[model samples]
Each structure stands twice: as C-alpha cells, then as structure tokens.
Target: MVVLPATLVPRLDFIPSKPHQRDGYEPEFRRGILFEIDLRTFLATLITVGSYVRIMISNLGRIGWAVVFAVLIALTIPWFLWGDGRVAYGLPVWLWWHIGWMIVVSLVFTLFANRAWGTGIEEGA
Candidate 1:
C-alpha cells in the first residue's frame, strides 16, 4: 500500500538494484507489498520516538534546542510521506498523529544509519 511519491523515479529513489526490483515485481500487483510494509514499520518507529520528545518539551516549556528538533521533524513528514498523497490530506487528527510519530522514528533512523554506516562517530576511535 505504500506507493512512493509520484515525483520519485523508482530506480533513483528506491530499489536501486535491478535484481531487487525484478524480485519485487508482480504483474498483477504492480509492485511488491514488501515496500509498503517496510514503510509502515519505519513510520511506526518514528511516531513512538516523537511522542517521547513531545513529552519532554511539554514539561520544560520548550527551548531553543527543542524548537530545532520540532522543525526538523516537520520537514521530514513530507519527505517520508512522499508518495502517499492522500496521507498528506487526510483527517487532521490522523495527520498530526502520524507527523509526530514520523519525527521520532526518523531521528531513530538517523542514529541507526549513522552507526551502521560509520558516518559521524567512529567506533573506538
């Protein structure tokens, strides 16, 4: 059910490997369901983290650093929700909920990717 953004060129944004694309394809379905599932999983994780950050901000009455995090999360919702058009214009409650979730989940993703790819911090170095 996760349809990538219409703006996205398949090979460029996702499924970079031809073999992965071929394996995921189904003539009847048009695309593999695995993509949708993966998207959902990532989103769900983000929302969870956002909730925690929100609580921290609420208690502290917000701060400059908190605002920075909030802005970053706001920017990311559209990026991740890219191809889910209806998702951008659904019920207000649902939209807010998902947006919040995505913020947290994305931060987690950033941390995980950095560690996995050895981006910023070098382990034991």
Candidate 2:
C-alpha cells in the first residue's frame, strides 16, 4: 500500500461523475461498502481547488535525480537498525539515524528548491 504523508488530505473518495466500469455503471460500491460524503465538504473542496494550477514534475528526463531520492527514502526506514541496542549521546542509534537522515533530507530539499525548482516545464511548453 502506497502511503501518503499524514499531513496531506487526499482528494475525497467520492467519484463526482465518472461512473465505474463495473457495478452496472452505478456510483455506489460493488462490495456493499457504503461511503458517505457530505455535499458541503465536497463543494468546499471543489471551490478551494477549482482555480488551482498544477505543475507536473516528471523524472523522465532526470533519472539520476529520481534514483537519488528513491535511495534516500528507502534508507529512511532504518531496516538495518531494527535490532540495534546501541546508544549514542543518550539517544538510541535509530533516533540518531533519523536525526542525521532528516538533516540530509533537508539539505536535499534545499538543493531541489534552489537549483531545480520549475525546471523543464518552461522548456517543454
């Protein structure tokens, strides 16, 4: 299961208009799972995002950049440190790993924002 950050409120589960290919072209679920979406909440979200402009960033032209981030994210799980009982500076090894990982993440974000922000879009258009 792909996981999104907890802070992000994803687009609601309500499919506004497009009927499903299954379920006899109906809007309801096929497995008898009932979902309730409020009209007020839906309308509020629509208005908020109605005027939104999206910038699509694909790593098709920058495979190396994508690989770098993928490696960084994979190592963030600290699978190797699961059985670690070591302590450094009064903190567990995993905690120290996360702190250092966060620093690297921050630096990568800084580099991306400063150097690669909005790259390729203008050229493509």
Off by over 4 Å in 2: 1-61, 120-125
Estimate, for each residue in 1-125, the C-alpha lDDT of model 2 and write its tens digit.
12223234344456332334665566544332223345577567777665342322344435556777899989898999999999999999999999999999999889877776765555532
| Clash number for candidate 2 | 0
- TM-score of each candidate structure, all chains considered together: 0.23, 0.47
Pairs clashing within candidate 1: 4-83, 5-83, 46-101, 46-105, 47-101, 50-104
Top candidate by TM-score: 2
Provide the lDDT at 20 for model 1: 34
What is the per-residue lDDT of model 1 for residues 15-109, given as tens digits with 9 covering 90 to 100?
Answer: 32222346667344344322332567657878997988766654453344356557666765556545554544555545775667777777766
RMSD of each: 23.2, 17.1
For each of the candidates, give the backbone clash count.
Answer: 6, 0
Among the numbered candidates, top lDDT falls to: 2
